[model samples]
Target: MKKANTHLVLNCIIAEESITIEDVVKKTKLSRPTVVNIIKELTEKNIVFKSGFAEYTGGRLPTLLSLNANSYFAIGIDFEYPPIRMAISNLKGEVVLSQGITVDRSFSRNRIIEEMFEALERMIGESGIPMEQFIGIGIGLLGYLKANQGISLEILRIPEWKDVDFKKLVKERFGLPVYMQNDIHMMALAEKRLFLTDRADDFAYVGIRPGIRAGIGLAMHINGSFYGGVHGNAHLLGHMTIDINGEPCPCGSKGCLELMAGEPHVVARYKALLGDDPDAESIRGIRDIHARSLGGEAAASRILDEVGSYLGIGIANVVKLFGLTTVVIGGPDGELYYGLLRDHLKKNIFKNMSGELDIIVGRLEEEMYPLGSCFLVIDQYFKEPTLDL
Candidate 1:
């Protein structure tokens, strides 16, 4: 309980750049002596520093405290898909150094882990940050994960990753605590901390990764907590059947949204529409489609409209089910297609729903995954002690 109080007090101070003991006591509802003692301990550890004196009321001025942002560090990695990304972050959630390595199916699971370890080691060595400052490692991946047990039950795209004890492996190899979560869930966590801290707590994050084989993935924030249902696969919204008899998905479902609006499918639809055009051969991916749409190509625009309509249907179902007022679209493909899809998505959602909804396209860009993974570690500092990492 004392440790928990200390954490809470530290979080209060961190949240407010410069705060007094009275402020922390008020925010945490802890007794004044407890807040003072915790602040003293933190100051002794150099984790919290005396910034300056607060305003002088009638009596003496109280000392203001602030977090020492560089006192600790964490490492985060996103290994779900190609171009594995990793970063080292400070206590303030600022990325000090980040790097990426591309991989293909040819790289076995063991090989991927080995390469990841090497890259992380090289990064730490180059950054000149002391290893002792790092609290733990956080990893975000694509799959059904038993995050509490640090085991990945199944990864849709990587068949070889079945039943792997990722938490134990990482912890044993690095001699540090490890936290694991689904990629989309991690992104939602990041969104909560970085972008939506002042917004609604009940929102949904929908991500579309093009090459992962798995369709769209979703993570929900309910009542200020990330709700991963039993089996850690709740809200597989991508697999939702938008078309009853449209196309077969690997999940054995017909007319799933992933197959209908995912990047690869959208690209294929564009190519098919081009049908024997000499320029059709140049259309390789969604980016090309986006470019053509920007160039006012009628076929490309029509294909994007269709994709957006399908995505809107999926998002509408999510909004109706969760009664969510905000839906944030993210992921590599999502970033590229968001602008093209926003209006159609909004129109379909408004047509289906009764109230106003805030549809936001994520702006985290390339830092989305790694930074989210980093928060997987940073979040430990703010959660209640009884909560599992």
Candidate 2:
């Protein structure tokens, strides 16, 4: 009962940013004495502190209490595919440390895991915060995850990661409670909590990554809550069929949107447009292709134009299916190519249906994935437990 009251008071303070005991009492419906006791306890622990005095009235002013953002911390790791990233965040959702490691295909999964551990050690050591200060670790990974069982069910070409128990592995190494979720879900959660603060806004977020194998995902925030499907794998928009006789996908579908707009396809298209075997290093990834497009390379621009059209078709389908007016494009590729892709994507969407759709790039970009991962832990730490008789 005491812990619940403290959490309730703290949540009230966190929501208002700064409030007096009278305000907290009214908001939480707790008695004056109960609110005072919880505030005293929280203040002594340095979790809540007096920010300043409230507005001056005719008499004495009330003290304003605010949550100390640095009281506790969480470690978030983005383990989606390669270039695994991590971030340490405070209760305020601010990143204190961030780092990543890109693994070569030649490197075994064991090697990659070792790199992750080493990175964690270095990050913790560098943060100058005590190990006990960290609440837990949050991890976001690609494909479907059995969140309750702490297992990943994604069928991967990487044999070592097939159905791996990542939660157990991380907990064993760090001895901290671990939380896992689909990467796109994490991103959507973070987007809602950190950036999209408006409770009435319903939107769909699309993350696009261009690499050896491209990744595309969708996360929806409807009615102010994440809409994870019954199995938590609802929006696999990349696998949506765009062509009837296009290239086959590993997901056992041909003419998939990913095949037409993914990095491999983009590179293939660019090379074909060049009409010659270009140096392999000249166009390493979508980043490189974006650079070429910026450098006035007609082939790269043409490829982006086509890719945008295909992506627009896919996004249009999502908008119509969900009846969403706002769509956010995110991920590294989205950040780099949004300007180029926006008009094309908009035009294609208008072609499918006439409506005013707000298409924009995600504000968090590359940082959202890791930060969102951290939020998995942060949200749980402050979560108000359910009351059951």
Candidate 3:
């Protein structure tokens, strides 16, 4: 009961930003005495502290309680991209320091782990923070995961990653608790907390990566919590069938959304239309295609329009199913052509449906991916301790 009460009081304080004991009681529905005792205990533990008196209008100025913000720290590592990104974050979820190490699929699994360890050691030494101050480490990787067990069910394109128990490995190495999650899901958590914490509680983040290794992912924040769906495979928006008769996907589906609307397809469609043009040979990636679209290349513009329309169709289906009003398009490829994509996306979304929906480009930097992983640890640190019944 005490543990649950503490959790409630702490969450109330966090939600209100800063609050007096009276407000905590009111918000948490706990008795004033219980609230006071919890606050006292929390302050002594440095989990929270007295900020300042509330106001002069009151006879006895109530002391405002706020999270200490540095009582503990967490480490976040992201392996979704080529570079293994790592960061240290305080209790308030602010990144204290961060670094990235290059480790692609070409490296052996052992080599990747060694590189990560070295980077982590260097970061810890530079931060001057004691190991005792850390709550745990969080890892974000691509593909599905047994998130509760911190096991990698499978990482697409990485042949040896099946059923890897990342949580157990990290815990044994560092003697700290560990959490694992899909990288895109972690990014969605960061998106909600960093950008939309105040404005919206429920929204969706759409991340698109285009290449020989093309993909699209979806992460939804439902009622202020990350929704990973059953089996954590809900993020496989790339495989969402858009056409039953279109080209077959590697996932054994035809007309999958990623095959039709992913940026690599945009570039391919542009080249197919520009047949035998020697200039087409110089067009290497999405960025080159985007430049052409900007320079009024009709072929490039048309391809982008087609891709954008396809993306809108997919996004609209998601919004309608989930009843979400806001959607954020993120990832490197999503951001690069967002300007051109947004117009076509909005048009198609409206064409298919008749409700208001806000589609915005993500404003966070690449580091948000790692920071989002850190949040997994930070969030767990504040939750009520539980026991098996």
> Across residues 220-263, which tens digit of lDDT does each residue of candidate 3 receive?
88777788776566757888898999998767789998888776
TM-score of each: 0.91, 0.89, 0.90
Show pairs that collide, candidate 1.
Answer: none
Clash totals, every prediction:
0, 0, 0
Tens digit of per-residue lDDT, candidate 2, span 1-389: 77788779988999899999999999999999999988888889888999999988867889999999999899998886676888999998899998877777667777877888998999999999898889999987887768767787873545566777888988999889999877887877777777677634689888886567777888888877777675567788889999988888888889888888888877877877777655644876777777877899887888877887888788877877777778888876666657756766666554545456777677766755789988889888888777664
> On a 0 to 100 scale, what is the lDDT of residue 154 in model 2?
70
lDDT of 3 at 298: 89
lDDT of 1 by residue, 25-89 (tens): 88999999888888888888889999999998968788899999888888988876666888998
TM-score computed on alpha carbons, candidate 3? 0.90
Worst 10 residues of 2 by lDDT: 347-356
Q: Order of candidates by TM-score, top first? A: 1, 3, 2
> Which segments of candidate 3 are over 4 A away from where they belong?
56-61, 210-212, 272-276, 333-337, 343-355, 385-389
Which 10 residues in a row give candidate 1 its minimum summed lDDT? 346-355
The local distance difference test score of model 2 is 0.81
